[model samples]
Target: MEFGVSTFITDEGIGAADLGRALEERDFDALFIAEHTHIPASRETPYPGGGELPRIYYRTLDPFVALTAVAAVTERLVVATGIALVIERDPITTAKEVASLDLISGGRMVFGVGAGWNREEMRNHGTDPATRGALMDERIRAMREIWTAETAEFHGEYVDFDPIYAWPKPVQQPHPPIYVGGESERAIARVAEYGGGWLPRGNVENLGDLVAKVRDRAGWRVPVTVYAARRDPAVIESYAAAGVDRTLFFLPTQPRDETLRTLDEFTELAKRHT
Candidate 1:
């Protein structure tokens, strides 16, 4: 399995270009960054990890801008959105941003997407929490249309548009690869329908079985990438043995020196599996 790093590239952490170069120098295959447009103060959405939300949740750099910087600085590292919240974004603008990033990066973009957990955050974006999944599905389909069609248009329940022109189609034909992020049956179904890969968190139950379930439901060999944020080498080895295509280790949000040290630690751990 290939190895990479994923993190909330925050304002306080290592800068994108420097971090990207360091990751490339360490032989990491990719750098996936997370995003959150804004955090609402009056929030009842408990974090998925079960505690107060981390400071990094509200402090991430815009994934496209950061990943673009990463792509500019590195030749081999794939710059990716670990889970760009499609539910909270406009499909047309997002589609253009993605295509432009893919073009600028010379085809090095992995569009990992998810319907997020923060209800308040989505609500602040004018997204109804109850119907966000359906909305996200429509948005993704619409984005696909925008990426591929010459006079792109989508008429869907949530996303609608007329035939419109979009420029700089991605270097990767038909658009960059998409990996759906979530640990739900609905997410698996989405993968079966449209995703090029699956991005499941590493700490889930019976991962081998879950991977099998996704592949079985898809009726094809879908590439599996575990977002192994727990930073445990043994579990990552288990993921590898279970036939995961790639595993991304968590890199903490810290200053450049601390970030580099963590990268070195992750690099050492990755050597066991990569």
Candidate 2:
């Protein structure tokens, strides 16, 4: 399995261009960044990972903007959104952004999407939390139409548009690879319906079984990418053996030197498995 790095690119951390260059120089396969438009102060949604949410969540730079910077500085490293909240974004603008980035990066873009956990954040974007799954499905379908059709149009409960022109099409033919993120059965169903790949959060105890389940449900082999994977070589090796296509080690938003050191450590650990 190939290895990559995923992090929340915050205002106070290592810059995107620098991180991208560093990852490419180290022979890493990709660079994935997380996204959060803005954190609601009401604190209604509990952190998925538990306890207080990290400061980086509130200070993250726009994923497309940050990945564009990464694309500008590196050639081989895949630039991706670890999980762009589809429910929170307008499909037309997002489609343009994805296509433009894919063009700018010479087709090195992987669009990772999720329904999202923060209800308040989705509500703020005029998205109803109860129907986010259906909303996400329609939005993704709409974006796909926008990316591929000569005269794109979509009419759905959540997303609708008339036949219009969107340019630069995308360097990756029809569009960039869409990796749906989540661990639930419903999430897997969505991946089967539309995604090119699956992005499951954290280390899964029964990863091999999960991969088998995805294949059985999707009726085809679906590539699996595990995010926030442990930096242990044994753990990575186990995942590789379990049929994970890529494993992205999570990096904390830290100063350049410290971040680079951590990258070096992870790289060394990954080398053992490769």
* Alpha carbon lDDT of each predicted model: 0.90, 0.91
lDDT of 1 by residue, 58-133 (tens): 8998999999999998898998999999999999999999999999999999999999989999999999999999
For candidate 2, the lDDT comes to: 0.91
In order of appearance, the predictions have TM-scores of: 0.97, 0.98
Residue 151 displacement (Å), model 1 = 0.8
Report how far off residue 39 is in candidate 2 (Å). Answer: 0.5
RMSD of 2: 0.9
Q: Against the true structure, whose lDDT is highest? A: 2
Quote the positional error of residue 168 for candidate 1 in Å.
Answer: 1.2
Tell me the deviation in Å of residue 261 in model 1. Answer: 0.8
- State how far residue 9 of model 2 sits from its true place (Å): 0.1
